[model samples]
Target: MDNSQRKLGTPKLGKWELFAYGQLVVPMAVIGLPLAIYIPPFYSGTLGLDLGAVGVILMLARLSDVFVDPFIGRWSDRTHTRWGRRRPWVIVGVIIMMISAIMLFVPQGQVTNLYLLVWICAIYLGYTLIEIPYGAWGAEISDDYHERNRITGSRQIFLLIGLLIAITVPIVASQAGSGATAASAASRQAMAALGWLTAGLLPICLVILLRSVREPVKGHSVPISFAAGVRVAMRNGPLRMILATVILGALASSINAGVAVLFFEHVAQMGSSSSVLIFALFAAGVVGSPFWVSIGGRIGKHKGIGVAGFASLAAFALVPFIIYWVKPNYPGAVFPAMLVITLIQGFSIGAAPILGQSILADVVDLDTIRSGEQRTAFLFAFLAMVRKFFEAAGVGIALPVLSWIGFDPQSHANSAGANFALTAMYCLVPLALWIVSTTIIWNYPITHERQARLRAALDRRTARRARVRAAD
Candidate 1:
């Protein structure tokens, strides 16, 4: 359970072992999907916080990661504990996450924005501690491209399973008490249950992952200074492009998520059944992840992601048109079309994270060639900032736009312009970004052949270094 794990060296992860390692993502994903999709609305509808205030507070909390994540990543890299570099941070993170989850989510009385902000900050801090280190560990555990796809794909599948669980909570609450649209006491209690479930789940899974998996074999590392890490992180060409694709893709997805509930409530009018639609979308991602991994193996990861972006772009572009066409006698009909389009988009969802992480490992491999060290921790930390920034940015933008379009509490029966604003933000804006991300990712230089060559060269370098050490 401690640094004694470090001496076990790099062990080949078998299929069941991979499954156990991936199982750990479920707890974090359960926490994550709700944080992005549910918590803001939970605060606004149930707790009576203003939309803008919630947006700003959440944005600030996420923005703090721009500064905080690098240090956490660096600390994990340098950590030489018996529990291994990643496990200690993950353990501490789980405790903080549990405490914060209970305090922020299961409110007994009136709570202030300040209270919400403080707890949100704590939750995100713990989230960062776990996610950044854990991601680095995954990258370190493998060098084979197809094998990594299996690793990341397995983890992504678990993540989708968690999101599916989070998605069901609304339906459970709706049937138990007031219907889902109202955000009533039933819904609040359901969310409270979710928090406690996550609190219970994290420790169990943390124990499983630590006992099951071990880190990769690493040669001597000339510790990367923060300044040097920053320089390499910036100077690396593919990393920059990868970061760009990640940011833009996240921006698009986040924008769509920001207005999804509103679109369901005001425009589509799906009511409590909204969770079903959301669940379908995520379920598709679960089914599609392995397919994407296979496709990435066939093509390059970057090109595979481009195909996903194109598919997502087409899906989002069709959304408003479907809504527009279905608005009158067939307003309910739009939900089916939404499900189909989102199912198509789900292919992209599965591809993005799996390939993004896989490519980061590839990029880190190249960085190791140059710097003579494995720096997965800080490198992945940089990627995490891109994802966090866009997630916050998307929500931040959506809330203000709603206010500007005259969407207030009484305005669920929104004006034509307000409706127009919702559709445009929900569909077209994301569509545009999706196009850009696809274009950028399509030409990304790393290919399967190139990665093979890179690995071969690195092996030769390692053997030469070993020969030199033996002579000394």
Candidate 2:
């Protein structure tokens, strides 16, 4: 909004407060990255579970989140506590998450599919508990359009920091000829260290946020059944567009992540260099966060996200060329080429989600303005559900497809055909998903100007209610 018009109850969180709020996501990324990239390999590659079976188990377990996320969101909205709605859930979720983080990562065993399923479900459940409500909390914490962008971006920076830390472990271990070696003493020790770090950090981060960042007071959720809430959520038009964006983005991202270790290890032949490439990728994100926040401010977050999507596509376009041309002919240049590509891709990777999330706050505002109910948590929860569903589906398909294409990590040396399959899985699938995501978000309905209008109208109605109550 211009200087002439600032909406009431527009939150202005200071830098430190925003930092405090964003810090909680660090350990989350540390724990979560393994689930997506490392732990799957650890199980299928290290523990000797069949790839197809691991994929199925992972899908079913994480898929359980679709049910739990919305319920938790609904419960979060309905809760009334002196500590506040989201924080209570945060506390509970973090405790569950820390315990499960240890379970998922720290185990040394003759790994059973059942054991994997149980802990994966526990981690997903705990993650959902924190992530959905936590996301909703950020949505409600501020009303300013650009300020919300700043909040999401700031948090993303810290998320990248955690990622860099988490990813650095494997890179360094590999340099020492130890980590990501798969089913080795050094690998187990490296993973154990990561587990302990995650378990240790989850609570510390949550405690800082709980002590520092204040939750905006909210009344009980609109009295509606979960069924009705789903209907209401569906009826929100802009939200539907955003949901499509989330799913498509999730699909592209999950596929790339699920395939990353294998693709790098075999196709790109990155080997010990994989970890370094990952660290560089997220480091690029760290550098890109503010650039994206600026872009959001200038062209608006939707267009900004569109820009990011296109940028990501452009960067991804280089992947195949790098794999085919650089890796085969100029072997040493492969790592450097990938380093550049991932860093550039990371720039957009850094931007798209932060912008999408920032845009979601505005979209949620549109929902509140239309429905006359601030059902933030449920909407965020539903978005989380869609994302998880797609992520599970993508990984489920991607992993099995890898096996079908002869990705025999057991053999530790894939054939040329298998490497080609890895290239297609890594590059082509994600390229298609990114294009779809870009198209989905290209004409997003809510803009900054529009969001300001909605917020002002809501403020006027809120003032009217206060006056009526005082008169009574």
User: CA lDDT of each candidate?
Assistant: 0.79, 0.80
lDDT of 2: 0.80
Model 2 agreement with the true structure over 1-472: per-residue lDDT tens digits: 3311323356666788789889999999887888888876788877778998888887898688787777888788877887778888888889899888888787856569988899889988888889988998888778899889989998899999998888876545544665345323226556677788888999789889887777776632236676766787789888888888888878888888887887777677666677777778898889989999999999988898888888778877988887777766888898788888888887777787688888888877777766667878888888888899999998898889888877886676678888788788788988898898898888987887888898888778777777877899
Cα deviation of 329 in candidate 2 (Å)? 2.7
Q: Work out the TM-score per prediction.
A: 0.94, 0.94
**lDDT (tens digit, per residue) of candidate 1 on 105-126:** 6875678898888888899998
RMSD of candidate 1 to the true fold? 2.7
Question: For candidate 1, what is the lDDT?
Answer: 0.79
